[model samples]
Target: MSTAPQGTTGGKTGPARETFSSRKLFIISAIGSAVGLGNIWRFPYVAYENGGGAFLIPYLAALLSAGIPLLFLDYAVGHKFRGSAPLAYRRLNRGAEVLGWWQVLVCCVIAIYYAVIIGWAAMYTWFSVTKAWGDDAEAFFFGEYLQAPEEPALGFDFVPGVVYPLLAVWILTIVIMVAGVRKGISRANVIFMPMLLVMFLVLVATSLTLPGAMDGLNAFFTPDWEALAHPGVWAAAYGHIFFSLSVAFGIMITYSSYLKRKTDLTGSGMVVAFSNSGFEILAGIGVFAAIGFMAFTAGSTVEDTAVAGIGLAFIAFPTLVSQAPLGSLIGVLFFGSLVFAGLTSLISILEVIVAAVQDKLGWARVKASLAVSVPVALISLVLLPTTTGLFVLDISDAFVNQFGILAGALVAVVVLAWVLRKLPMLSGHLNRISSVKMRTTWMVLVAGVVPVVLAYILVNEIIAKVSEPYAGYPAWMLNTFGWGMSIGLVVLAVLLTLIPWGSGSKDKHDPEYEAIRAAEDKEEAR
Candidate 1:
């Protein structure tokens, strides 16, 4: 068959061919994009930190109101356009392709650091096998693996740690992705996603059997109504929802671009969101159950039993694994499973960079992937300076994870919700294939309530942080700097909105834009 319709085409193609069914492909792609590190690590932490059970209320609320509706909007953009972000936006709004380019830039930056984290996971897997972590295991795990070390500390220098491994794994990721979506990404997910679920189930089963597992589960599920009263908790819930759902990052746009137009928008979004949230809930159960087990056996509190940082997954999880029947065998499987999860995510991250380079530069996928891989490797090297590398990774992650994603999401929501008047189209598409229509309540939620809530989060978070005192700087001036830094992403997004993209002669006839009538015409012809 012909190569997939990737880049934008010049001539009219009668509403680009739909080789795949949207309902089937979109579900897979959406799940692939959503089920990443956020569900595994970030969601549990935010949920646990934000009053555990209390966080659930706002989280589910956002899921129903903001997350699902917004996700449907993203899926509609991608599936409707049958192109990646750059071309997708070019179809929607000629001027807003700046948003497209911005999305690309953000993905590129995040991918640079994401590779290092995956490499760290790889390094941890090796360490697990060899049991080579010695007395300095804690430092090695954190300094070397968790945080990239800098300058004359253990595992110092970028090349030995960050640069080479990142390059190697990224190249590997590119190879998987370059194999094309169906055989490469989809096939891998079909295999790896099941494995992740199985491993997770086994872990959960074992944890529940542990002495205090039920207690920990209760702590997790037990209601803490007062916790919901805290603004910070609500903010954390919203942030986690965005992060876990993989909204705002352009991944959904990119991945969904591969989807066929007839996909069940509402149902697929629900599946993706619910499945990912289920995994997070499962992971939480396993994490806290293990925490309870370790605490009871070791005579420690849950806080004391719990280990944070990179070592937790490697050293701590392995400790639990070692105690299981066939400990070494299970340990290998656990870390091995983590490697697959990490790799799957790593490739998706790399694909963002690859897709962006191809769109902007018009290079072939393989060439673009290779070009991006080199710079990413060099950047990863920055994390090799003792534990300083690790620290930088965290800083980079923090910026992109919340600020970058939230900002991009804000733009996306504004574009789709306001600029495009996309909700009605989304509803119409879903109403066609779906048995049940998404309630009108969601339209109000997406356009009015969600944006206001996101804006509140954006402002309150920055202001709250800015008001805090810090050392070694003039407090007032430094506070101003803090405020600026916090709102930096929002400012960057606003700046992009001011710019516009060059439109093609075909702009007015964009099959993906105001061409629903034309789409139907093409369908009738087919």
Candidate 2:
């Protein structure tokens, strides 16, 4: 209920919020966040696994029903409140501020390991010249390059190859964040996004010319219509759309909080959602085409060569580069695209943490940026660039994405729909500012459909993980890195909310807050 002093840009605010220079900048930066390493590395394999070309039906349906609706909700909340997640949520219901902190904490945990992946991309960008991964790409990536230990619990032992590049990545991220939102994040995306598209297109074009490209495309697009009936396929479609769009992570909310008042919230959400999914489709074509070439070389089928996550990016792709015509050049373009995609996404993730610190503590932007970045950088340098880094990163990524991001989002929807009963007001806000007006259907999706789907995903994933150790890793490893980190994040979020909100005025005492309260009181009286 606290508010900023007079002269703030928004009528109700706690701190001075940053705005993107234009709608174009906001959309591009948003697309950059959405079109990340997952688009290139995760989506192709997900499609191949989940009914191939027919996966598109469920994926697009999820986008419409869940993805875009949640996106529009986040945009509406942020723009209407004119603050970061914590401040924005606090305005809605003071007790719900912890939800925002939970999201920011999730972003911090993600940022810690995400930087390490960007570092790997950086190293590979150089390694592309010589195909340094050599003949056994898998062995080279896991054994020589990463020096992965025999066990997940082996602990950190720094590898110089990864540590140096990781340090460089952290430095680059800190520099961009320090430059402020419009000057740093916006401008960087202007350059990175278009370049990413051009490089990816070039790689895709080259991949299609390779021998057996059609076999890869066939493996990718050939549909098994029966797979649509399976509950798991629909779940995978929803999960991919959710994660790929970067919702439920506070990235979209924070980014939207930086927009001008008159911006089209629904139109912007549509652009970001469609742009992200479109890029994923393009990535599927490119990835499968390259995999086909690899299969042709190995005398195997595209299905045999298929993989996902880090393996697909660092191992399968490198092996393809070593065998393909103009292998070195292709390698450069491929990894270079990864570097750009990872950097832009990294910037967006870091911005969430930085914005939270500034909003809560009234800290200068530089101080906030450095305060969060320095510790995370040190952690990355000491732990993530080490022998057991990949195992740690893998476990942490799975838990944080499932437990942290999704759970926080579910809480938000329940509070808005059932607890506060604010969905109608939020829908009204979106309709007022957007060219594409939201209807009751949009409200149903946000308040009812999306939350139900997310809750199912959360419960189903938890049951699956508890019933069996994930990926056959030891129980201790899952307990330590997976469940342990997730529990720690929740504890941290609660602890953060206990800190007194340092806004200059008392809660529920600010003029704007009183006015809102008065209006609600009148509505109830009527």
Q: In TM-score terms, which candidate is top?
A: 2
Question: How far does residue 40 in candidate 2 sit from its true spot (Å)?
Answer: 0.5
Predicted model with the maximum lDDT:
2
**TM-scores, in order shown?**
0.82, 0.94
> What is the C-alpha local distance difference test score of each model?
0.62, 0.85
Q: Which pairs in model 2 have colliding backbones?
A: none
Off by over 4 Å in 2: 1-15, 503-526
Q: What is the lDDT of candidate 2?
A: 0.85
Ten-residue stretch with the least lDDT total in model 1: 12-21
